[model samples]
Target chain A: MNRKSKDGKILLLQGNEALAEGALAAGCRFFAGYPITPASEIAEHMAMKLPAMGGTFIQMEDEIASMGAVIGASLAGVKAMTATSGPGFSLMQENIGFACMTETPCVVVDVMRGGPSTGLPTLASQGDVMQARWGTHGDHPIIVLAVSSVRDCFEIAVFAFNLSEKYRVPVIILSDEVVAHTRETFVPPSPDEIEIFNRVTPTVPPEWYIPYEDTGAGVPAMAAFGDGYRHHVTGLTHDERGFPSQRSDEIDALMRRFFRKITQGFHEIQRVETFMMDDAEIAVIAYGSVARSSRRAVIDARERGVKAGLLQLVTLFPFPRRHVEKVLQQCRAVLVPELNIGQMSREVKRVHRNSSRVETLNRLDGRLITPREIGDCLIKMYY
Target chain B: MAEGMTGLVHKYLRHDKKFPHIWCPGCGNGIVLGSLIRAIDRLGLDKNKVALVSGIGCSGRMTTYADFNTLHTPHGRALTFATGLKLSREDLTVIVIMGDGDATAIGGNHYIHAARRNVDMTAIIVNNQVYGMTGGQYSPTTPYGAMTTTTPYGMVEHAFDISALAVAAEASYVARCTVYHAALLDQLIESAIRRKGFSSVEVLSNCHIQFGRRNRMASPVKMLEWFKENAVRMHATSKMKPEELQGKFIIGVLADSERPSYNDEYEKVREKARGISVEPKPPARFEG
Candidate 1:
């Protein structure tokens, strides 16, 4: 099928540059980061771009401070973000956990390089999918979005910030090195084209404001510093007034509310794009740069009459499990080809535990999974 | 209400939510906290425009009882958060309070960098010579020959003159005072809060339970007496020999200069970036 028409002005960009421009467009006025491989472009762009926009950009001493600064800026009532690859992302986990515990809304873009202590800094790998979910300590909830192409990076960057502000949480934009380094034409939408969300504020006067009270939307309205709210915010688990309350009942209530906030908002939190799935029996699931190959594979499989389709996962966390399970219920078997070995495949299998066999096409050699490799799997699985 | 200082304490402390503030009885943190409150009160800074950030430990608890926009961060990370918050919103009077270990031990990197940058924030470090909250463990400031849980026999490492370190690290304003010198501590803090660049005060505070119990100075009065007896003034330091100053430190304003703050420097950067008075004009917001 030939694509017909498109709107918006075109600008050629790499995945990392798209992410930087996308974040700026999404109302990110504060960026603090330490440079790391495959993700330095974002920081460079911010350093070059933020100041002219009357925003703040800082090259922090390290990644821990970068994440801390973003959280700090967010608490001061401005949208903020930081980007890093795996090693820097590892350092960021400490404050990432801090942000989650304190319920600070911000964005973190982890352009994936092979990791587990800087395993292939210059190469591409979808190695941080699970790290994006469980990299930080504790059972705290997080939202992560995966981008497959340059244009998608721009779009998802906006979505990531929107989800962060709407839910008052940190949202991770996970991009692989292939997507990060490759160049593509990105269309810039008009200002009103994308929806932006700000943290909900208490309508009541400052005296009556309970900083952590559930706003019936599973989120506590956040008051910015200097807003005359004069509320205490801490990393320790606390009660409605935002002070450290260690009572077991209070802990349980707060913990349950953290999960409910993301779980109840699943419809908005989960995003996936389906291609040629109607009347198809076999599907290929992929994300980030691997999805680019999977797209070509699905197209070639269709030309060969294999009845193959593509399930592009845009939202990797809160893991679109229900939707994936529903899609798997219609297919015979799904092929998952990612840049890493069996990260998201585990989530897919767990979701479709008894429904169908979940096949994996993994690559760990720092190279892209080509279209033939995916189409071969499709042919073999379908026949 | 109770009369005298207790009345001011009652009025300033957040008694409803954060009462019985985790601080132990006769703790010198109470004295140090009182001095901080008196300084802020004397400054007449609007509570809404003030922000108090603290790191993990006895000192971090100060944020909870303070009725400002307070933040209690992880151990050793208060300065980084304060820097971020202050940089983003230059309208707030940001103040950071940390313990000896929280400042000079784990967060030493952030402490020095914040000072080097000379950001417009006041950092107050309460040096009780040991990590009291985690038990009587040796901290960065534990003097040589001091015994603690970590150093069973005695501390083999040399102690840091935190005030001198701040002065060396290019902080715009640095001072030192003991909890015993309450009124002088108030005056130094008032001047620090008014300083336009990085300002800090190393308070040679007390730890009656931790350092006191381990070192045979078990009572609160004995610790206060030690501070009163051993404290030296900044003016008197020049007359004393280096050997004579052993096991004691001077308490006064050690350094003060009107260096341009990081916030002010960043403004010039913004102006240069936008070509406000020269060169080509850049696009607004995200367009560039």
Candidate 2:
């Protein structure tokens, strides 16, 4: 079956292409990125399409500049994004921290590949799960989303942009080489069908506007560069007026607002999928490409008279802890499987509150965790 | 006629922000700031249309005083940020302020690349010869044999001629001026900002508190005298021999050329994509 795109034509789209199209649909008018494997297609697609929409696309010298440009463009009252793989993603951490400190809204697409240092460029791995959460130094709040399929790629990119704009924070969408390069049937949402969220502009006059003022809602209205609101923006620990403040109280209040905006808005940010987990003794928790394999394993286990269910994580950073906690209390034994050596499983272990036994299935040789391996593990745990 | 200095200050500065700035007394940064505002005032550009982006250092704090849409970014990345701002809002005038270490040492890649790409922005790099904000560490433009906190046993590396590097990188406009020459500094900055492509103005500023005390020039006056006695105009250097210009540096515009800016060239790409003559019509509409 074929699904219609914006032009009302059915098309087979790569995951990267769908992600770019989703960004365009989300009103992303500016893209700045350096070309890297597994993620370069996102940049290529944006370069080809952004101009037709009367948008801007720039191939910056490196990922550092690319991240800087995206943040800058976002401040100029346009939605902006950047894409990179592991190596380039590592280079973007400096500016990423700046974005967090300044509360700038932008999107970063990191296509996961095997890595410690320029690790496998073409092969798939979920190694960047931890890096996405704690890559930049300091205790900062970040939103990380994972895609399990090509269609998920399209939906998640739009969600990422909306979350970033609504909260005024940088959002990261993690895609592995498997999903980014795979071709699948895609039905893009029409412009009117999907809701779009833009950053809130200042409603007050220029004299009353404070660039970083916390209005009890934790998010402040933003003003563009050329707007009459001549406000100052800095990465320093700033006061309500956006000037660098060394006062202990001001710094404490500002840092608290950064976390408060996300934790308080989790209702709009977090998502998870539970499959047949209502009355099951055995459960599997997974995310990204590994979730697809785990879903298959759960279905196969049920056919063999074993009660098995699957928990698929979409929001990875603010770690869907409450949902995972519910599953932990209901199930007797849970298995966590992933491509990397137990990154997300650690989060599962951290949220363990009940008497349920938790175990992890791991792989690191640039290969996807197969359904057979997960099924075997589920069978052993059940028997 | 140029506006009175006090009027320019009143019109362009943010009075509500932190006054009594962080720069040391007798610092040349204040003079450079004055020249910048005078240049902007002389050009008659609207305050709402100017975007002043700065990088980390003592120089980066310039944005705190300016009334424009000021942004103080991370160290060495002001050009990158300015590039995005200018490309997105080409209607606005963009200016980037950076220090010696901020522009040449940590941001050398962006400096050269911004020149190569020729984005329409003016970069005013304050070459104070040392990183004054970080306690006088020797920077990329620290003169050889000059003493700094990092170069205790006399400096071993050579200094970078920032304007020459900009010229080599093919910046459409490149010029050099010193803080002591405030009037000339205003003219160079005004012209650089008016140019269509990437323009760099390297201001030889004095860190009287740091580099000046460590070197022979112990006070601001001594540093100003050094700039006055050792500088030669660019036109006069052609007549003078190499021996006469051994220790002296050239001042004035070194390179100015006409080339299409990145934005103008990108417009052509936009036309090729969406122009009626190039784009083919859809053969048939899809029936749901």
Candidate 3:
């Protein structure tokens, strides 16, 4: 896996393969995942690669176990991750919520495939946009990134681990089947070139260390399981001492900190790639692989003497509301094309004051929305 | 590290913040916890080098009360987490605590797989024969024909021999002891903790508040008395017929063997992976 060449050569690899390399570069020493379509390659790569790098990769019995194990490894002070698709993602929700409640830093990669159940195991879809945000129960904070390119599959993975450590929360790297299995060439970033944020450790004595004590950053310093600063971690609503508390004040305080940690940093957390949007009457908002279709559609609309631009979302959660509102203000109509029936459209409408100004172009036939379909929708809405 | 068993209890238990243990008054979790504390102390295990994981149940609450790297996860996923924790940092001693229902029902698949892999951790399953935290539901280990909230009349489900299951799953060490047998429970737990491969010790504990009351053995004392009368040692089970052993609780070292644990085998994989010769596969498929 550490096939670092002295010549700085670019390695041709699939999106999932690049992810394994990226995680290893970011100091990930653990991977636990159950095999599933679109995401299975990531585990296969990890199984073949991790051990060679002195890391551990375990293909657990199921997705539930896989998610639980990754969180456990993260608590043991290793950068850990688990990769899965539709069915596996549903199974992983329980422990993802537990990781959220426990404030353990880990990464979960959901390679998007079409589905409500196991609808399409190998086809691309962004149907899980809402699930990625609210899949876990309760009002817990999460950071989810949608990567559209093979390069992003590598870079954002390193970024996912960084965000997870910085916020002390599970950061999801969402990849569509197209992006996951697609092969491309990219120069792997050197360890020194990529900025990695490791979870901060407490300077105080073991007796004084409160595992869940929120500092000025809102993210608490974490002590690993074997760090000698032995402390408790639990999914139960816990006090600052990290012990379960039924006291209303304790529960309130913990939940407030969890949400505030990410919500307050919305400006830094939200990332959107805008194309040709400086002056346009029509705006198209899309994410994941659909963004590629939307981009081409925007270009075609421009050539056809119609003013159009693209709002390609890279960060999906805490849904770039301000950016969405800004784009809507400049444009008369917004076209949101997704693989599912209007999951992100609702989010867009929620942010835009005039919900009627936004239109959803959905495709659920186990196929991707084409450039022509998006172009047609933009014209129908704005022209 | 120098503390005796009693001193370790004071040292390890979170006295300031965690008080008033959450278990019911008549529950045997206290004895179970006490035995565990003593076992860890006697084994001279590093308190800092241990990570305790537990699932949702009365037993799940134990991790929060212990002064170690503790995780309280969803019901039945403790062993999965423990496996991950141990695999990541092989130096740390990971222990998982779960109730009978949590271990044998919802978490059954993970439990069997962990033992099958021979994961290097000690699983301390507190079997009270019923789901205590969520009220009285019949667990997989609930004695056949016992009344529970879920099993209104008599339990229609068969009892599971979890220790025997672990042994069959190839756990390096498998043992069981009742709360009435406090000294034996502690000893068995200590031995399990000190063992290398995947080891388990089922702590047959009293849950008078849940599993009793309906079965006509409501008091905690009556539960203990039943355990004292019914528990059979390992050797006696060999002499008894299936019919004769129907009402008995086998409590002893049921299985013990030597095998390379999961972690041990993984290290060999890592050793073999280093600078291995690579040979690309021959192309067979038409498409690139």
Ten-residue region with minimum lDDT total, candidate 3 chain B? B279-288
Candidate 1's DockQ is 0.49
Per-residue lDDT tens digits for candidate 1, residues A222-285, read 8999988989989999997888997999999888989999998999899998999898799988
Q: Any runs in candidate 1 off by more than 4 Å, and if so which?
A: A1-9, B1-4, B276-288
TM-score of each: 0.96, 0.97, 0.96
Per-residue lDDT of model 1, residues B153-257, tens digit only: 999999877877789889999999999998999999999999999999999888989999989889889999999999999999999999999888689999999
Winner by lDDT: 2
Whole-model Cα lDDT of every candidate shown, in order: 0.88, 0.91, 0.87
Clash count for candidate 3 is 0
- Residue B79's lDDT within candidate 1 is 90
Tell how far residue A301 is off in model 1, in angstroms.
Answer: 1.5
Q: What does candidate 3's lDDT look like per residue over B104-193, in tens digits?
A: 999999999999999899999999999887889889998888999988889987889898889899999999999999999989999898
Q: Per-residue lDDT tens digits of candidate 2, residues A179-280? A: 898887656666678888988999999999988988777999999999899988998989988999999999999999999999998887889999989878
